[model samples]
Target: MSERDADSDDPGDDAEELAWETTGTEIDYTCPGFDVRRDDVVLPNGTETGFHYVEEPQAVVILPLTPDGEVVLIEEWRQAVGRVNRGLPAGSAEPDDDDLDAVARRELAEETGYEAGSLRQLFTIEPANGLLNSVHHFYLARDCEPTAEQDLDFNESIRVSLAEYDDLLSDVLDGEIRDGRTVTGITRYELADRWQ
Candidate 1:
């Protein structure tokens, strides 16, 4: 049964279903990181609309937890925002990356100079589902230890630090950790058992 008509037990369930039909699409712009596109879609009410959206590549974020239960975070300058932002180690998938976990591990090592003893995925999230088409794969890297010097890109400048898990959660709830993906990761880790 269609979800819109499930509660009513109506015979015309198919008629009550809401959907949008994409009649046409055009690429407005294409760049290295993302592409902007416009879709011509007809709504359930038969109204035609032009929806502009961004198609971004998939990305990954990792929270590296040390043996003492400290969470590894990165302090980096965001050129787009013109300010220093604190967040988990994260990066988009490179062309050679096999999967999201590869991207996550590479980002974690590159940004924090640590290797995870045991890495496990927490969840995948779509922080900007309305405007951007991308997924942020979140992982928990426990028992992390420094292995090598950070290998950052020329455009990247990052400082790494470890904070207590509770303290990180406090910062997240107190508006200190403002990055949306980082917030999602921390909240997911903090509330995992509760959700299960």
Candidate 2:
């Protein structure tokens, strides 16, 4: 096993102590969707900046690795992200969903027309700091049971695809999989190596 920094967020912080300090305390701003905050800080180079931040919700993603080592990934045309990329079956944790597992199963079926026999928590990712605070959760769902129903987004021109277990790693390493949540899910699946 490779030893990594305990705090992945502050990896660069160890290289040099922040030769700066926050002159102004963090102040919250009333906002919709996600709240924003500002902090006046002096940089290590002695420059001041207003560190504006935002709050985001926790997201859920599913890695449906079939018994044959084929992984279930979704290809959706995301307007916000501005690209049609491949990713694991994923969705947000909406309030009153009541059943996270059910939500996961529903998303899997809706996005890819596949249902899961079982689910397992794998890992999470924090993609940004400036204006996003989202926990991208990963899970493994195997032995999926496909359904006849397809309820994808209206503008979602999604095409489900599969990648072999071995090729999966290479694709991720070569930056072929650019979606952050999906990348985290793949790495999580590799970490335990449960399917192989």
Task: Give per-model TM-scores.
Answer: 0.84, 0.68
* Lowest summed lDDT window (length 10), candidate 2: 1-10
lDDT per residue as tens, model 1, 95-124: 667777777778889889998899888887
Which sections of candidate 2 miss by over 4 Å?
A: 1-54, 193-196
Give residue 115's error in model 2 in angstroms. 0.2
lDDT for model 1 comes to 0.82
Question: How close to the true structure is residue 37 of candidate 1, measured as C-alpha lDDT?
Answer: 84
Against the true structure, candidate 2 reaches a TM-score of 0.68
lDDT of 1 at 123: 82
Q: CA lDDT of each candidate?
A: 0.82, 0.71
Clashing residue pairs in all predictions, respectively, total 0, 0
